[model samples]
Structures are given as C-alpha cells and as structure tokens.
Target: MSIELNEADLVSVSVGGAIAHPGFPGLPAEPYRLAADGTPFLLPTFGGIVYNVSVGDRAFGWAADCIHPGVSIKGADDLKNRGLNVFSCLGNTAVVMTGQAQGAKGVVTGKSGRFSEQVIVHFPVEVRRKMAVGDQIVVRALGTGMEIRGHAAVACKGLSPSLLKALPKKVEDGVLKIGVVATVPAHLVGAGAGLTSEGGSLHIQTTDRAEVEKAGLSSLRLGDVVAIENTDSRYNHGYLRGALGIGIVGQTDGPRAGYGPGLTVIMTAPKGELGSFAAPGTNIATLLALEP
Candidate 1:
C-alpha cells in the first residue's frame, strides 16, 4: 500500500485556518543533532499508553513499564485524515501543544518512546534540525488503528482513548521522564526482538544487566514508563521500511548480537536530567522525578 495523505491526512487543526493554538515553543533555532546518514529518519517518542497485564495476560518479557510516545509532530485540525493521528488522554492536547512541532506540521505515525525518545516524527529529511526535544513542531492528530496493533489514536476506526484506558495497567512509575533511559546489560533484559506490535516493544532494550536484575524481572509489568539512555543503540531504520517500531529494537536483520535491548521509561524529565532509581547493572547516574 503506497501511503499518501488524502483527506484522512488533512486534519485542519484550526477550524478554518485561524491557528488552533498559540503553540508551545516553536522549532528550535538549532537542533542538537540531525540524521547525518540520511535514511528514512524518524524521531522516537513514547508509543502512548497501554495497560498492565494480569494473571491471564503477560508482558511476556516485553518492556512492561512505560507508554510508547507517539510519532507526533504538532497539532493540526485535519491530521486525522492523513492516516497519521492517534489520540490518548486529556494530555493528547498537551502533546501537540508542547514543542516546536506544535502548530507546525509533520506526520505522527510511529509510536516510539519505550526506551527511545523524540516523538518519532517522520520528516522528509529536510526538517530534522527544525525539531528537538525542547522544540515544538506541528502534528495532525489522526485516528487509531486496530487494538491488535497496540497504538494510540483519536480516530473512531481503531485504537482510541477508551481502548487505551481499558488496558491492564501492568506497571506504575508515578514519575515521567523526558529523555531516553540509560542502557542496560544485554543479558539481563527480558525478551523483545525488532518487531512486535510493529516494533512497539522497542523501548525495552537496555545495556545494564545489573539494572535488569535489580529492577527485578518479575517487578516489571506491562505499561510501565521506564527511562533509557541514548547511545549508538546499534539500531537500524531500514527495518522500519513499511514497518513501524523497528528502530526501537535496533533490529538490523537477524537477532540483535550486541547490546540490543529495550527499557521502559518512567517519564520525561528535562534534558541533562537523571533517573530516580538505580537498577543493578545500569549506569543511569541519578534518580530523578520525571515528566514526559
């Protein structure tokens, strides 16, 4: 299916072009980084909310702590038509209102943010520097896909806030951090490959085995928001070709051989911030109360 923005991609944002919001902070004057390699790049964000598993259900070794940030830009009225919008929470309004992407425009498709950060806005390779964690871009909220897909959306056709609210609530970390969590040991993390729920499980990758042990594998339940660190991460974007969430797991082609693990971020703290808990094997540096 060749994706194209029809009316579905055309959320007007403003009722008739009056400007939906004054907007959060506009695009940054200078983004910290851009895709030097220049593949079909996407900024990672939290995939949105899910529920904690129960006796019949299980995280099944997935990153059971946090919500994957949606691949959002800013808010627009007709983004729902473009097949890009997904809504969850009263804060869905806050998402489009937060950064440089706010009021601006882009496609909010991939739900990233498990261990990754950045709202995973898929740009045309020209707009990378225009956005950053602090910068606000514009997003067109689209509708939800299917529940089996495990994503967030406002569209009545698929996963919506009701579905998001209805999930199990597997884990709870009262705090929410902004940036990615530190890496954990490869051995200690539970289980997640490159794809599941279209790569929704990407956030569980970690580089700290000790943190895994300390966090207590059993202590981890689905839907918990854990943080992660931003490293080379050994991830590949091509895996996402016609695929979503592939970047989260760093799935190049086969099984991840080196440091390919995911983490559940608790929240979004400010940049240069630290986490609040110290797991056994990871080097998170500090434990902070975060909000993302």
Candidate 2:
C-alpha cells in the first residue's frame, strides 16, 4: 500500500540563518576533551562548512566528535536560532540566499546542539566550497504538522513529509514496518535524553565497544536510519517497555563517555506499532538522492 500523509496541508515557510562557526564551552583553559579512553584531544567538533564530509560517508575515522556534514547554520540571535532549529525539518529544501553560493540549493539533514543550536544542511561539495561561514541560507521549512493518514498512534517529529514518503516503509496489519540499518538497544541511549524530541538528537553511547559490536552499531554511518528499541520519543526521549523509535544518524561518533553517534528522532510509536527490519541502504543520502 502507498504511504499517505497530509502533505498538502503542511505550511512551507522560510527559516534562514548564516553558517555558524565551531563552538566551544566557556573558553576552556585547554580546548581539549577527554575521549572514552580518557585521552585528551581536540579537533573539529561541530558547525561551519565541512568541505570534505557529506551524507552517505562513513561516520567514523574522522578526527572530530559530533561532526556535522555540509553547512551548519544558525541565526545570530539565540531566539531566532531556536526558530531555525525547530522549524527546519529533515529533507526540507534549502537555498543559499547570499554570498558566492547564491541560488545554490541544498537539503536540511538534521539539527544539533543544546545551547549552540544548529540546522545541518547538505550541499554539493562545490557549492559548499563557494560558501563561507556567514553565508545566509533559507530553508523551506515544512513537515512539522504532518499527519500519517490512518496511523494516529504513530507520531512524527523533526521529519519532513517528503523524507517520510522517501522512507522504506510499509503498512501491514496496522503495523508500520520500517527499514533501518540497526536497532539500538535502550541501554545504549544517552545524551539528549529526557529532552524534547521535536529538535536535536540522542547519542548512541559507544563507550563499551563490546556492547556496540554486539548490537551491530559500530559501523553506523551518518544519515543511516536506525530504530531505538524501547524508546518513547513522543515528547521526550526515554525508556518505555515495548516502545519503538526510528531516527536518522544525524551526527558523527564521539569519544566522550556518554556521547557517540547522534540520531535525530523522526518517528515513534509507544505501543510498538512501528516495526523495523535490517535494511543496509536506508540512509537519507540513498533515500533522498543527496549529492556531495
């Protein structure tokens, strides 16, 4: 059966911001963070235009933690940045409004940070090269009020109707079956927990390599769709028996104790109405045909 949603009623509006530079905390005496192994190191963390990385690339081997691909954008004003973060949905179309990359189009991939607040956009590498940190980008924000025709139990959050349609899903016997790269056990859910799921993401803790390997999460790629087992993300991310949450790997893996690959929650069903299967090519890049 075809996936039907109220795509027409969703209002598409403009939410724009300039690229943000990588942020730091309180001007730490030493701009270094301890890895899971307790090794102090520092590298590119988040924000700015990442010229080399893009969706579909492996989320590991990078010298950075919580790294975002393409252009990371946010309004200079804190309140406006929140608007940009909350309104921009995954798979929304974005366009460079000013600077050398004017008129260039992109896709909103994800949102990150608590206080820093950024909306991640995926642009072609060449288009990204022409972009600068202060370049303004306007996203055609939609999908916040999407309705999945008959599935009242399934709540959609931070997901575009376009991306939802592009998702590998099927409705069988009233259950929505989705394709994901892996199912993250509830024990591994960390960071951004107890926070609103409308924006931001939850990190999949990779401190225990053994556990990560056992759960088949060691090879998670950016933009990869994955299911969080026993997670209730209707309002906030928390553990609930028999609940299931589906999200896209939005950021890179980190070395911090409770930090790892961040997954932006897109769909959730409290009573396990959402089913998932191991699907290798279910990444956003593949589903959305993102280039560069």
Q: Which candidate is the best by lDDT?
A: 2
In Å, residue 262's CA in model 1 sits off its true spot by 5.3
In model 2, the worst 10-residue window by lDDT is: 110-119
Which parts of model 1 have CA positions greater than 4 angstroms off? 1-57, 61-201, 205-211, 229-271, 274-292
lDDT of 1: 0.27
In the range 1-292, model 1's lDDT, one tens digit per residue, is 1111232342334211111111223586432222223323222212222122211122234442222222333223344312222232111222334444444343322333222222333332233333443344443333223222211211122122322332222222432112221233223333433422222224342334455456444343222323333311123211211111101122111122222233312121222222233333221111111121
Q: Return the clash pairs for model 2, or none.
A: none
What's the lDDT for residue 264 in model 2?
85
Q: Indicate the worst ten consecutive residues by lDDT in candidate 1.
A: 245-254
- Candidate lDDT scores, in order, read 0.27, 0.88
- Tell me each candidate's TM-score: 0.25, 0.96
